[model samples]
Target: MQETAYAKINLALHVRSRREDGYHELETLFAFVDRGDTLLAKRAEQDQLQVVGEFGGALDDPFGNIVMQALGSLPRPDGLAITLEKSLPVAAGLGGGSADAGALFRLVERAQGLPDDWRQRAAKLGADVPACVESVTCVGRGTGTDLEPIDSDLTGTPVLLVNPRVPLATGPVFKAWDDKDRGPMPEGTAREIAEAGRNDLRDPAISQCPVIAEVLAALGKSEAWKVEMSGSGATCFALFNDVEARDAAARAMPSDWWQMAGLLR
Candidate 1:
């Protein structure tokens, strides 16, 4: 069986306040791209994983990979041999690891079935895992695990994702936040919320990786309807009205930068 680990992008992330537990209270819009890493699996005597693709080298330790942890989290009476195509850049605010784990959950779900406490299992893997397991546009609150699916107007919209080829870790980015209540998220369709809302981490992320500004500037030059940084730093996205416009923007990116163009899932 095969599944696509859809690339995740935060249309708008509002950091409400810093929590007493280290994690920040968050209200964000999570959207997935139709293109991302691919996972192929088949029954085997033992759980085995092989990573291959453009960014596969970044994940040197197969045993340490979150995909393995996800496998360990579930009750798999039959071992599965998996191959992960790592197309998305690591630590680039794309949720590549979480997406891969989510894909594993999906594969297992299809072969057998998820347990009643699947959400809890996903949450233990990561705050973003639950949302990624569904891989749909939704409102994520409380550190991004609490999901409320919405009728996303942005569905099937053309989107271009660009990264400066820099890996920005999530911990430092959140630590750099100013820790101010940005208030509640605006109520509206996903597109409206994305347009009206803002990613509070933009400034902090930019402060950490200044090249992010260059990417945003470049995307801003396009005829995109909206351009903003995803999750934290390094990677930014532009939403366009049509595929031609999105592909044009993708072509216009710098030669050294990494980019992918796809429709929103």
Candidate 2:
């Protein structure tokens, strides 16, 4: 079986409060883009996993990669071989690892005839895995595990994503805002995300990596563009009114930075 693990951008992320378990309560509108990783899995004569692609070198430690974790959670079938094609940056708050785990779960279920309970097992691996498994626009809350499906009409919107190439740590970003209390997202369409609010982590993210602020500024300066930081840090996106404007802004980005523009789906 083969599946694509799509990357997601937080249209709006608001950290509400801290929970007893030390996890923060957050409300965010999550949207998946056309860019991300890919995974190919099949039954092997012997149980094994082989990953290859850009950024695949970093996943050498089997235990550290979520794909291995998801595989371990499943019943030992005949055998398995996995080839992971990583396209998204690691720890960029784009849910790359989680999406890979979700893809692994889906592939295993389809090949082994596993039950739907596989998603529940996926949740145990990571909070964002369940939503990644669904891979659609939705409302995520409570440490990012509670998911409610939203309208799937965002495919028409255009998005230009730019990664500053400076990795920001998500732990420190949340720790910087430990005492802050953020407001909730108002009920509305995904198009209203720009006016909803900003991610509380953006300030700390900028503090950690000053380049992020510059990226945000560059995107915001574009006419008819609404720019915001996705998830915790580093990867920022600009929503344009049309594909032409989005492509123009993407082309205007710095050559050293990583940028991709596509119609949101």
Q: Per-candidate RMSD vs. true structure?
A: 0.7, 1.7
Q: For model 1, which pairs clash? A: none
State the weakest 10-residue window (summed lDDT) of model 1.
178-187
Give the lowest summed-lDDT range of ten residues in model 2.
Answer: 188-197
Q: Can you write out model 2's per-residue Cα lDDT over 108-153, one digit (the tens) per residue?
A: 7677666657767878998889888878888998888889888865
Cα TM-score per model: 0.99, 0.93
Model 1 lDDT per residue over 193-244, tens place: 9888888999999999999999999999999989999998679999999999
In order, the Cα lDDT scores of the candidates are: 0.94, 0.81
Candidate 2 local accuracy as lDDT?
A: 0.81
Query: lDDT at 119 for candidate 2?
Result: 64
Best by TM-score: 1
